[model samples]
Target chain A: MDFFIQQIIQGIAMGSLYGLIAIGYVLIYNAWGVLNFAQGDMVMIGAFAILVTHIFWGLPIIPAFVVAIIICAIVGYFVELTSFRPLINSSNTRRLIATIGVGIFLRNLVRVIFGADPYPFPSIFGNTPVKIGELTIIPQNIWNTVIGFVLVFLLTVFLNNTRLGKSMRATAQDREAARLMGINVKQSMSLTFIIASVLGGFAGMLISPVYFVIPTLGTSLGNKGFSSALLGGITSNPGSMIGGITLGILEATSTNFSTSIQASVAYIVLFIVLIFLPNGLLGKKESRKV
Target chain B: MTLFNKVYKATRIWILLAVALTLPYWVPNNYYLQIFCLGMIFAILTLSLNILSGMTGLFSVGFIAFFGIGAYTSAILTTKLGFPVPLAMFLAGVLSSILSLTLSLPTMRLKGMYFAVATLAFGEIMYQLFLNWTAVTEGTKGIKGIPALELFGTSFRSYSKFYYVILVILILIIMLARNLISSRTGRAMLSIRENDIAAEAVGVNVPQYKMISFLISTFFAGIAGALYAHMVRYVSPESFVNAESAAVLAMMVVGGIGSIPGAIVGGIGLTVLPEFMRFLGNIRMVLYGASIVLIVIFAPRGLGGLIERIDNILSGKQSLGVQKKQQHIEGEE
Candidate 1:
């Protein structure tokens, strides 16, 4: 029972990290109707940014995290400006491929700058497992869950109450309609990218202590995060959260049975979900008027 | 005028055949010959992918899975079962087509990014299977010492010999693609790409046409894979990954999605460009990514469109406005 409970905690912690990244996917999809294939790389860049600030520059942990996220947001802005913006009127295939190009470029650029070696990320939470009634938990895991929930709550609030956030929602529903309503659709899209990038950075910083900072870290995680978004319905924020956590739990539990195929479990699940539940767990059926 | 056009077309084909046949003479050495061979192999693969993505408007990032299946099937057959190289190659293609048909049954319903992701998953699953199925795949140490192609008692062991073999295969495949694109089935595929609902309303069996397009593409991909395995005399999981699939997709896009001549140009250009850019070391990938983004932004029609534009200019035919109108209609659709 204790072992199962421990697995659940671990799964939740991991799920929260995935949820953070999935939020990025959801945010971008909602705002621009474009899936950013480079979202994972954005997360990777964020972790590297924190690593450089905290470790190399000897900055305080909290400030470094903040700075790192800001840098990621800037990167996201440029990504939209340079690649996504120019190809806004192009086909989805072209847009998707361009994002992939940006991903490839960013990943290779990091590889050139930092080399391929994995760097040990400095743990913001002190290195000690807290014990509670036969349940031993890492402090960082608790922090991860807390941070994830906090961000989700804040994002929900912002989207619901904030003017910029409302504009973003409007843009997502219909770009032409949003423009006619006197909303700055372009500005809202850029803001969405910035916010999504920041969330991706936060996820990276949160998970780096557990997974180590590596140039290739984003590839698999990005894939899994996308799967989570799909699992929850790409358009729903809360659904993404549930999807990420569920996938994380599934991954954790499956590892107990077979370690060899663990890497493929998420993808297999994604394939099944895509085929059987295209609308996802919480997604509405989208109708096309042809 | 009709007679002149016919004669000109015939003359061009003859000249192309002559050039292809005598390529080895002007080629400097084995290194360049091997590059040409690699380029031709990629050309075949890109063309196969084009049949689905370019013509049928299905986006698949997992054609490498079919390529890998072909490579492994041929490698195991020739090396383990002692089958002749030619028989193994044919069986490999057949198997790949069958597998693709099976995959299409479940995945053909998906559109756009959903389809891309599903295919991507399929490729990853195949890669993992190749890596973990140690007994058959030998588990990443890779299958080695596979024999090269032998025909009429002459072994194609040298680069020049392999070059001719690949060139002949490429020519045949190109002809096959050209013929298919002009056929009834080809028209159905183009219709599906233009609008699946409209095609279905017009009495086209959408699913069957999709399956056929996928089957044919995978068949050719399998042939290319088998050729690759035999030429390299090895098979490994590392060579057939998402990166490889992406590279092939890049080639297809760079060449011009549905154009056969574009596939050839894109395949050869991308394959050879990397070799030439080897001097830039790690930065080459950055350049590669940048170029892809730039190409998509500025010239989404790719090199094939450029070629058409040049042809129009040479003939003093100003049909640019008409072409733009056609593109606008397609885009609106």
Candidate 2:
């Protein structure tokens, strides 16, 4: 029972990270229907950014965080401007292939820059086990879980109350309709990528404190992002948040309790979700009249 | 391009097959001979994937799973059960094809990127099972000493002999692919790929044709996997990693997705590029990956497609349908 509870709390903490990453996927997916295979690589870039700013340059933690987020957003915006925007006006197939190209290019490019070493980031939370109710988890894990929920809460308010957020949502619903409504479709798309990339970068930075920072750092969370996106049902913000935590915790529990070969768990979870809930947990159900 | 069209059109295929079938005996060095032979098998694997990713419009991330299936099946049947290599290879192909059908039934219902993800999961499951089922698959240690495809009662223990056996298989596969892709079935698959809803509206059996293409492609993968096992004389979990799948997909993309020539040329080009890069020391990998970027961005149609365009210009023939479609595909964006 003690082990199970510990596993559950840790799982929630990890799942919350997945939820954060999944938001990046959901945001771009909503604005533009491409899966942005580079989403993972973007997270990788984020980790690298944090690595360069703090680990390499010996910058303070808070400034490094800001720099990482800004750099990540800028890279995301550049990727959209260079690769995605041109392909957007083309076929979805072309867009997909192009994005995959970006993914391959970015991963390999990072490989060149970072030299494939998994480095340790300085933890903002001191190295200690945080305990609550007979459940002891990594202090960083607890921090991640708490901060993830708080971010989501703020994000929801931003989406509902902010003019830019509503414009982004409007663009997501229908590009043509949004254009008719005087929303700049191109700017909205760019904003979506920027916002998503920044969020993904933030997740990477947060994860780096407790995680292995490497070129393939994002590779581990790649499919989980997709899984959470599916979990969120792709149409709702709350759906994405709930889905991310759910997937992360489920995977953590499975890893802690089930077979130790947990490498298979994420793919397994994805396969099961794809099979059972094709539209995802919070996905809006659709009916056909044809 | 008239050159490609004339070449792809019976006359060219016959000459190509004749040369490929006869080249193994002509090569003097055993290692170089073996490399060409291995290339033949890899070509078949690429061609098999091409049938689906290239012709049918379905991108299979787990394309190599069927190949792994074939390898394991053949390895087990020949080594453990003491069956003949020929029978093992045949049955391996059959089993892999059947497995493809099974996977397709449940997963093919998913569309676009969903299909890609589902196939990836399928590949992972297959890998895990292959690793864990120690009773059958021998765990991570893997089954070794898989017998070679011997013919005329002669075991192909030597590179020279194995060369001929693989050469023959590659030729046979290429011919079969050419004939199959030119048929009505191929047309239906391409139609489905361009737009499934439109194809379905026109009475194309979207699911059935896709399943068939996927199955047939896996059949080829299985055959190649069995050959690869025997060619290396070993079967291990490491041989069938997601990296191998990515390499195969990379070949298909670089060679030109959906084009037969693209698949073949891409296979050979990529297979040879790394070998040539090996001389560049460790920096070879960085340069090699850079080459992939250069090709996709500049000549997205791959080497085969590029060669076809040049051939068109030099010979005064219209671009082949494949080239036009690839151009159309890129142009649509």
Candidate 3:
């Protein structure tokens, strides 16, 4: 029973990380009806930014984190201006391909700079064991779980209460309408990318200690996060978070069967969800404009 | 058309065919020939994807799944069951198309990003099977030492011989693609691409055309996969990774989506470009990445589109119906 509890805790931690990445997908997806394929690379870039700032420059963890977010914000802005802006008037397929191109560029650029080897990320939270009754838990796992949920909560609050968030939401709902309403539609789109990129960077940094900071890390992690978003109502904020948590728990339980099952759990779940709940668990039915 | 124009068209086609046939004679080394073979294989992939995505507007992100299916099918058939290469290759295509039927049925209802994600899930599931199904796949060790192409006691052991085989297959695929694209079914598929709702209103069966495009695309991809397996004498999950699908999509896009010649040029150019810039080493991919962005931005229609523009100028025609339709696709919000 303790083992299962412990596994659930770990799963929640990992799932929360997936939640962060999924939120990033949802944000950009809401802004423009396109998935930012490069969002995963943003996570990788964020982790590397911290690696360079904290490890190489010898800065404290907090400062390093802040610097990484800032760097990612800049990256987000630049990516939008360069890859997406020029193709704004084109089809969604072209925009999607452009993001893919950016992803490949960023991933390979990291490979060129960092080499193809995995790098160990120093633990942000100390490796202390916490005991709750008969259960022993890693401090980082607890921190990850707590911080992840908090971020999700904070993001929800921000979206509901803040003017910027409302404006961003308005833009997502209808760009033409938002523009007509005198909202800075372009600014809102750029901010959406920025926020989404920051979330990706946060997820990357969060997972770096657990998983190796490797160039190829983005693809698998990104795929899982994308699945999480899909599993949760893709357009809903809390829905995706719940989806991420469910996926994490599912993964944790499946690990008991075999590694193969665990490895494919996300994809299997994705297939099932797509077939049964095309609008997703919490997503509203999409209305098409003829 | 004038007699002079007809003669010019025939001569131009014959000259291009002659060049393709006599490639080995003009090429410098076997290494270059090997590159050409790989280029042709990818061209088939690009063309197949182009049919589904460029023409049908399906936009699959997990196309390599079908390719891997075809490859594993051929590998298992030939090595384990003692099947002949030609028969195994044909069966590979048949098997992949059959498998696609299962997927296409469920996924046909999905549109845009939803469909892309479903295909991605399909790919990941396929990849997992390739890796975890150790009883047959050898669990990442991959299938190896497959027999080379042999037909009627004539062994195609040499690269040049293999080149001819691939060339013949490629030419047939191209011809078939040309015919299909110009057919009534092809026109129906194009109508769906332009506007599915509109196409449906016009009495075209959107779902049926989408399925036809998907099946045909998977069939060709499977055939290409079988060709790749025999050419390299190996099959591995690594070759069919999502990045490979992206690369092939890149080729199709760079070549000119929905254009047969575009798919061929994109496949061959992208494949050969990296090899030609061997000195750039790690930076080659970075440059490749930049080029995709640049090309899409500057030359939105891709290199194939550029060729059409040049051809129009030389022929003194403003633009053809095909080009006009392409503009409509781009111009549609």
Candidate 4:
């Protein structure tokens, strides 16, 4: 029982990191109606950006985090303008292939620049274990949970209340209608990409300390984020979060209990989720609009 | 579907087969010969995967099931039963395809992406079993000392000999694939990809089309797997993982999904490109990732589309580009 509790906590931490990355995927799909295969890698780029800024550039965590995310966001904005916007206007297959190409390029570039070796990044939260009865949780885990929830909460507040966020929502709901309403639809779409990228950037900073920072990090997490995006069913933001953490639990449990193959739990969970509930737990059923 | 069309197809295949059979002598290096052989192996797998994903649009993230099954079946048969190489491999391909087909039939009723998910799930389960079932597969260590293909009195040795055998297999497989895709069966698949319900409503027999796609894809997949087992003389579960499957799918897409020639180009281009990227050293993956993003964003049509565009320009014809009218006219189907 205690072990299960610990596993769940561990799962939540991992799930939150995934949820953070998944947010970028969900955000892209919500606005663009396309899966950004490169989102996880973008998160990877974000996390690496943080590591380079802090460890390599010798900047402190607070400022590095901000700068790294901003940099990542700019990179994402460029990716959107160059790749996605064109695809959004082009054929469906064109967009799919393009996103996949972007994902491949990004992952390979990381390998080229950083080497394939996993880099160690210091934890943003100090190395301390929090004790609660028989269960001991890593402070990083708690921080991840707190910050992830907080980030989404803040995002919700922003999307609901702020002018820019409202513009994004309107654009997401209906591009033509939003454009008719005098909202700059194209700019809003770009901003959505920027916001998602910024969120991914923050996620990378948050999780870098715990997970080994590597170029392949995005490849693994991208698959996980797909599950998260689907989990919230394609339309729900909070559901994406739930999907992330829940999948994390499934992964943690599978790792802890299932036989060898520490890495494939996500694939199994992904297949299971996809096979059983293609609609996802919270996702609205779109089904290619029949 | 015409007699003349059939004759033309056969002639073209024979020419390609003859080329594959005779081409290896031009290559000078033994190591390059080996790489050539491996390239053929990947091409076979890519062709197999193309039947499913490229033609039918049944996108699966896990195809390693048949690949691994072929390896395990061959390994178990040869190592335990002391079976002849030909018998073991033949049985491996057949059995692997059967296993893949049997598992796919019921689940295939679920259309589109759902089929992709189910196949992926099944693949994961098979990988887990291979890893966990230590008694047979030796767990993570995988099956080793797989006997080389011995036909008649001679053992397949030197990269050239192996290359010929693999090329023959790839040619035959490609022939089968070209035939299958160009036939009525192929039309049904493209229809399904375009719209599943519409195809069914138009009397396309959606279930049969899906099953046939899965069967043909896995048949080639099984052959490729057996080829890999024999070629590498070793098998590990990792070789058949989802990532490998994804890579194969990526090849199909990058090469030109649904285009047979595209699969070959994509697989070879990607595999060969990565080997060269080693010079970039540590920065290679970063470059690899960034470029994939850019490529997908820019070239949605993949390599096949690129070729078509170039062809149009070279032929002095103004291409319609993405306009639907020109696509239907240009597409062989």
Clashes of 2: 4
lDDT of 3: 0.87
Report every candidate's CA lDDT: 0.87, 0.78, 0.87, 0.76
Give the DockQ (C-alpha) for candidate 3.
Answer: 0.68
Docking quality tier of model 2: acceptable
Regions of model 1 farther than 4 Å from truth: B1-10, B316-333
What is residue A273's positional error in candidate 4, in angstroms? 2.9
lDDT of 1 by residue, B207-242 (tens): 999999998999989999999999999999999987
Root-mean-square deviation per candidate:
2.2, 3.6, 2.3, 4.4
Computed on C-alphas against the true complex, the DockQ of each candidate is 0.64, 0.35, 0.68, 0.43
Worst 10 residues of 3 chain A by lDDT: A88-97
Residue-level lDDT tens digits of model 3 in B183-208: 99998988887778888999999989
Q: Return the TM-score for each candidate structure.
A: 0.96, 0.89, 0.96, 0.88
Worst 10 residues of 2 chain A by lDDT: A86-95
Residue pairs in candidate 2 whose N, alpha carbon or C atoms collide under 3 angstroms: A15-A248, A90-B333, A232-A239, B54-B258
**Local error of candidate 3 at B315, Å?**
3.3
Point out where model 2 deviates above 4 Å: A285-290, B1-36, B281-294, B318-333
Model 1: per-residue Cα lDDT over A70-182, one tens digit each: 88989999998999899888777777778888888999999999998999986789988999999999999899999999999999999999998899888989999999999
Interface RMSD of 1: 1.9
Off by more than 4 A, model 3:
B1-8, B318-333
A1-290: candidate 3 lDDT, tens digit per residue: 88998889989989999999999999999888889899889989888888888898899999988998899899889998999888887778778878889999999999999999999988889988988899999989999889888999999888889999899999999999999999999988998889999999999998989888989888998998989999997998888888898899999989888867897999899988988899888888988766
